[model samples]
Target chain A: MIKLLPRYILSFILLVFLQVFILNNIQFSGYINPYIYVLFILVLPFETPKWFLLFIAFVLGLTVDLFSNTPGMHSSATVFMAFLRPYVLKVISPRDGYESETLPQLKHYGSAWFIRYSAILIFAHHLFLFYIEVFRLSEFFATLARVILSSLFTIILVLISQYFYRRDIKR
Target chain B: MRSLLNFLVRIHFLLLFILIEVFSISLLVNRNSFHKARFVNFTRQVAGNVFVKSNNLKQYLSLTEENQRLAEENNRLLNIIESTYKSDEIFFRSVNDTIFNQRYQYTSAKIINNSINKKHNFITLNKGSEQGLRPEMAVVSEGSIVGVIKGVSNNYSTVISLLNLDLKISSKIKKNGYFGPLMWEGQGYQSAILNEIPLNADIQVGDTIITSGFSSIYPEGILIGFISDFTEKGGSFYEIKVNLSTDFKSLDNVNVIGNLLQTEKLNIEKQAEQND
Candidate 1:
């Protein structure tokens, strides 16, 4: 756990920088804003304490919000994602269950489980984020399109990054 | 007591989650209040710096188009100046020059960041309180009305763009003087809806719309849009669609308008209401 602390801190800074500087600027047809910062929470070890997970998620989201100038939208969405992460893990747990010290990485869990896990959480995050940002039910379908397109883009980016850049998770 | 303590410990994670979520939502709801001003300003400064830096790198690619727009504006200004001088000379011979007062002043600013896709879109300007900008000033581009100032920090201000669903402008037909309230429908960037124009008013597909100046935010006769189509909603009013004159997607330079007589007008109206 002590050894992983520095790694998590480093990735948090790197992801926030990439998101604020690069991804926020990439408006592909004004619908897709790939939020790769959620990858920080997605890849945490399965046994990470729930309280710690929520705290980290809040900080990560608040940092992004400070950069994007949307006060609470990102933080609300990310906290909700963190709250749902454990239930999602429970639902998708294998017959043997997850290894205690293993991180939920694409390399560790294989493609299928990782895809399912990331897709569900990313969809939830995007839906919440878009709704909170818009804050209206009148444009429901338009906001939904934004959610789906952004979620798809974010998931693909997360997958591509995981596959190409292999990082060792100490067990 | 022991059993209650154990239960609380067991559900501590859930309690913490709820606490954090509630805090975030409260922050969202309190966004426009004065207490959130410091946080909003801090974020604005950070985002403003980043956008200004990135826009510097990207601005060169659109330099030619921007120059063309500026040159056209210069020509228009020259024409207005010459016409004004000619009229002034004619009026001076006929009557005294006491009828005109400078009611509005303009400050130019660059749009560092803008969005047209969201339901409540906002544009960030490089000007702020230091430039004498207030919360309700009108923002306009060379061609048409842009938006109204929503908030201001020290070095930057955010404008609620005309594309937002929350903003509605009083507009009128240019030819026949029939007027209505114009609002965005949140679908396309180019078109907006003008509501409550009477069905019997002389209107057409190609008629022009301009600011009515009924609201003090915008001055009179600024070009807003041209009527594209219309339909009768029930029996009395026409739902008119207008293609906006300013292309919000390519907005760069804008002017924030300061109405010199707004406070005086508002004060008089308030006094009248008090008497009534």
Candidate 2:
């Protein structure tokens, strides 16, 4: 079942629904809006083409935007992060890039490396999303505060999801 | 044709990024109109429903403290009323009835969604159109004025929390009635600034800031904040910082002040504005 495309598609739909309906509604603090939908962009196969990955990120973000009604905020931010993902991966590249069929996960890359990689991507996405939401250098300090707080919340949610749903990919 | 196809495939990600950026830029530029505010209000309604349930859960835990606070506040209000009026007059007007034409009405509703950390902060309330809430009604929490209602649905309304950079209210010093423009400095939730007060005016720290009754939204004499610090800016005006009384971050309930004569006052003002 895990070998099939339908399995991943099913999981993706479920995650997106849960995100828009449940997680988006969960406001732990005013600052913490956990965006767990980014997991769709994160767990794509290692061999997925760069162009395909970027396109997936665009769709993933646009879907969230459609539900949240924030217009292009998530899409712009996600695409920018997707554009930088290659460089981020290169910087944190494992011994053999990644196994051909393995997806990015702690089970595949270990906790430390996965955490570092996810943190960079999540921060990059959040920084772009928040700054664009309120586009002004005059609001720099406020934007920075949002970046740190939202990133922390996003990271914690992502880590918890990763811990519970360990992927079947081998290192 | 094959070579062209390969070239297109090579730069697909860059094309996608450009497309999304263009979309975002357009949204930002077009955000000022009423259409956009209405759209944002719809999003607030969805947020409000979720908040209502969560706040309901917390209400159980915080009931004892909230009840005690409400009772003590009611007692203080009753004592003030008793001291000001004859026993018969006091008895004639019920506690909930509006006695004086200037008296402000208070409606307690939970804040479903509040964002103080953003440059443009908005708050979603659990009460709305059915509860006599309409656009432009003033909101206050714990005696200090928050902001006016910007949008309303049947069961919810979005408030422009005082922390927003876009909101400016007319406020006066409690002691002297010297007026200034009150706005959030886009910094902390607890602080705001009063701008355009003349430099020569007698100003001091800890002076109370209250609504000036100049606007139809908020009635006069409602507390805004306290003057914490001031400095001469640009040699003509004193820029004063205020410590906001309402803790927006921990805001649970608010009173949406329904002004009786707002529509009539606004029509007159519109006519005046047009003539000017």
> Which residue pairs overlap in candidate 1's backbone?
none
- What C-alpha lDDT does candidate 2 achieve relative to the native structure? 0.76
TM-score of chain A of each: 0.95, 0.89
> Which one wins on lDDT?
1
TM-score of each: 0.89, 0.78
Model 1: lDDT of residue A160:
94
For all candidates, state DockQ relative to the true structure. Answer: 0.56, 0.36
Report the lDDT tens digits of candidate 2 across residue range B1-276: 999999988887678668766765566456445323665567556666766776677677888988988899899999887775757666565643744554456678777666654566777788878888887789988778888887777788777889776788999889988897898876667899998888778988999899998887788888988889999999899999999887776677788888887778889999999999
Best by TM-score: 1
Which candidate ranks first by DockQ, i.e. highest?
A: 1
* Local distance difference test, each candidate: 0.87, 0.76
Candidate 2 lDDT over A5-105, as tens digits, reads: 78678877877778765676566555456677777777777667777777777777766664454556777788788878877888889876676656687
> Candidate 1: misplaced stretches above 4 Å?
A167-171, B34-36, B74-100
Candidate 1 per-residue lDDT, tens place, A94-165, comes to 889987667788887899999999999999999999998878888789788889999999999999989765
Segments in model 2 whose C-alpha atoms lie over 4 Å from true places: A1-40, A46-75, A86-97, A111-113, A138-161, A167-171, B1-10, B32-44, B74-108
Q: For candidate 1, report its TM-score.
A: 0.89
